[model samples]
Target: YMLARSTGARIIVEFGTSSGISTLYLAAALRDNGGGRLITTEFEPSKVMRAKANLAEGGLIDLVEVREGDALETLSADLPERIDLLLLDGAKALYPEILSLVESRLRPGALVIADNADFSPEYLERVRSLAGGYMSTPFGDDVELSMRLG
Candidate 1:
């Protein structure tokens, strides 16, 4: 929430929307930011339905679009010209691929937060590398927080 609020994020892309818990947080941030959009993906149709209900119950349905499909496809197209924030909490092994899909759209200094990133050593190395164009460091336990450098 702080990241979204602090960044004044207007467009957020989330790799996972398991049960809409994290989605709620991001949607709240968008609402608090005075209006924005959140694009989150979930391959499970049941989970997607639950998430939509949750969002509606929270009165945040209007700010979020819960895409029911694989992140690789859902996040691949029709994205805003500039993405302010990205949350990676889906398949750990696919972190690098997901990052690549969103990398080009990330505005300069945009934040990228990854949960349970230890499972993807390649992803850690990529974000931590000086030449990767991201300034990154571990945040808390297994979360890696990075910002696009350019």
Candidate 2:
């Protein structure tokens, strides 16, 4: 929420919408940012149903479009020309792949947050590298905070 709102992120792409827990926060930030869209992907049909229900219940459904499929597929195309934020919380092993899918669209300085980042050593190494185009650092205990350097 802080990251999205503080950055004035108008378009957000989330790798996972597991039950819409994090979706609500991102959508709320969008709402407060004066209106925007959140494209979130989930692979499980049942979880997609629940996530949609939760978003509607939270009155954030209008601000979010929950894509019900693999993030690799759903987020591969038809995205906004510029994306302001990305949250990686889906399959731990797919972090780098997902980032690659979204990389070109991330506006310079866009924020990328990954949870339990230790699960993807490759992802960690990529983001942490100074020449990878991201100023990356660890946050809290298991989260990675990085900004697209362009």
Candidate 3:
């Protein structure tokens, strides 16, 4: 979250909103950054409700929009013109596809963080590819952090 904030992120798109744990963290950063939008997706209806409630309790619901559906569908349309930050923590199998959907909108120098990236070798490979338009490396244990270079 601080990484996103320190980089001056104002438009963040997250692929998972499970229980709103990470949502709250990102939203707090946005709030402290003087406000921004955090668009997050969750496939389960129950989780969506829980996440919404959690965000409301954190007083950050206004800063977030929870899209309830498969991320491939929910995140495929109506994205911001330029995304400053993207967090991928959804169905591991769809990481590459989801990245494709958002890749064109990523601003130069934008950050893409994929959690549990070990489960998506295709995603890791794409980001690490020499022609992938990104500079990427494994972050910590399970995360893959990539930055848009163009």
Q: Estimate each model's TM-score.
A: 0.98, 0.98, 0.98
Task: Estimate, for each residue in 29-56, the C-alpha lDDT of model 2 and write its tens digit.
Answer: 9999999999999999999999999999
Task: Give the per-residue lDDT of model 1 (tens digit) for 104-128.
Answer: 9999999999999999999999999
Residue 85 of model 2 has an lDDT of 97
User: Which stretches in model 1 have alpha-carbon errors above 4 Å?
Assistant: none
- For model 2, the stretches where C-alpha displacement exceeds 4 angstroms are none
Pairs that collide, model 3: none
Compared to the true structure, candidate 3 yields what TM-score?
A: 0.98
Candidate 2 colliding pairs = none
lDDT per residue for candidate 3 within 1-150, as digits (tens), equals 787779888999999889999999999999888899999999999999999999999999999999999888898889999999999988999999999999999999999999999999999999999999999999998999999997
Which portions of model 3 show Cα errors greater than 4 Å?
Answer: none
Given candidate 2, what's the lDDT at residue 61? 95
